[model samples]
Target: MREQPPYLRVADALQQRITSGEWSPGDRLPSRAQLAHEFDVGDNVVRRAQELLITQGALEGRTGSGTYVAEVRPRLTMVRARSREERGGSPFKGDMASLGKHGSWDSRTEAKVPAPADIAARLGIAEGDLCVCTRYEFLADGKPVQLTTSWEPYDLTAGTIVVLPEGGPLAGAGVVDRMASIGITVSRAIEAPEPCHVTDEEAALLGVARGALATTIRRTYFSDDGRAVETADIVIPVALGEIVYEVPINL
Candidate 1:
């Protein structure tokens, strides 16, 4: 077998130090030059190893300060279920409440935005069709945990109180209930989850490194009459949370 890369070896050694309690959370690591001398490798190798550990959430770099062992945070458990809508509130809020964390989100909505081809396809609309687009950053205890971009055909809710998803009397009522208010019942939603790397924009919002491993869920809600009403792309950083699918089995 090929020998492990020098950087990987160094990273393993550094990680062992943390796991063995030699270095505790918030404890600053040795300088790269010092580590390189101790490991008998180039400083570049030590830098790479530290970068790897930073991406893995084992270490963190502070501006003007040295690298340190990162404080371990419990991963948030996000439960996905068809019944979440029936529970009559934001599913994300419920998930956070289960863990005793405060759930909140910041959103920006743009009206009459032209849908791109891919988003159009997901909403079963033609490219260039007007849509209401909203970007959301979900937070747990004021820290971003998830991101979502939602699109819906402008005509579907035009001139209706539900047109602005985050505005009006039904503000934050959620898609399912909001649609129902407009005489359109959302029958089901289909979600396709896939592994993805964080984009620059996602990285900024999620406070993670670009190219970090994440999960993307492509979700489309459909009406009982078989019409696609809304579609959203949900992004969750793997280091911060986990996705759990709960399917009810009827007896």
Candidate 2:
């Protein structure tokens, strides 16, 4: 029987030690030479072992500092693609509530922003159409967990109290509710989830390392009459929280 590689054996041993609480999260690992001596392996073997653990996300190397155990953080749950007829409450807040954590968010809205071509297409509008765009940073226990940028045709909301999303009486009321307040019924929405990588700015906001795994959920809402009323892109960290959807199963 051939034996496993020495480095893999060392990594497995270290994994067990870490999981067994012999070393806690954020605890610096021993020097490569020290580990090699303890494991009765060469320096190269210990380096290979450490590199493997870093790639597996079980360990991290800090510049000018030694490698340490990675700290695991809780991920926020994302519930997308709900039927618009359903109440348009904040799903992020609901997720936080379910986890016994307080949820809040900050938003900035800009009016008369010309829609970019891609966004305009999603909203079924012409390119450069005037629109109201709002960016939201969702937080759980005051920590930013997700980000969203939503675009709505200004024509659908012009002269309405809800024209400025997050600025009117219905501020932060959510897409369906805001549209409903103006006699528009958003009946359904389409959401597509795509795998993504974290941007530097998103990484800073989400408090995750740059290049971390992420997921982008793109959603578009349509009025009962088939008019596209709103669209948004939501970004979530893959490592932090889970993205859960409540889809009905057909028997």
lDDT digits (tens) for residues 1-251 of candidate 1: 99999999999999999999999997999899999999999999998998788777788665447788877667887889877778776778877887899999999999999999999999989999999999999999977789999999999999999999999999888999899998999999999999999885776567566578999999999999999999999999898889999999999
| Candidate 2, residue 151: how far the Cα is off, in Å | 0.4
Give the winner by TM-score.
1
Note the Cα lDDT for every prediction shown: 0.89, 0.82
Mind giving the per-residue lDDT tens digits that candidate 2 earns over 1-251?
99999999999999998999999987999999899999999999998897788767787665447788877767655555354236466555666776899989988889999999999999988999999999988888866778899999998889999998878688767777888888998888888999999775776566566677988989898998999999999998888778877887879
In model 2, residue pairs whose N, Cα or C atoms come closer than 3 Å (at least 3 residues apart or on different chains), thus clashing, are 75-240, 75-241, 76-241
- Model 1 TM-score on a 0 to 1 scale: 0.75
Give all TM-scores, in the order shown.
0.75, 0.70
Lowest summed lDDT window (length 10), candidate 1? 200-209
RMSD per candidate (Å) reads 5.6, 7.8
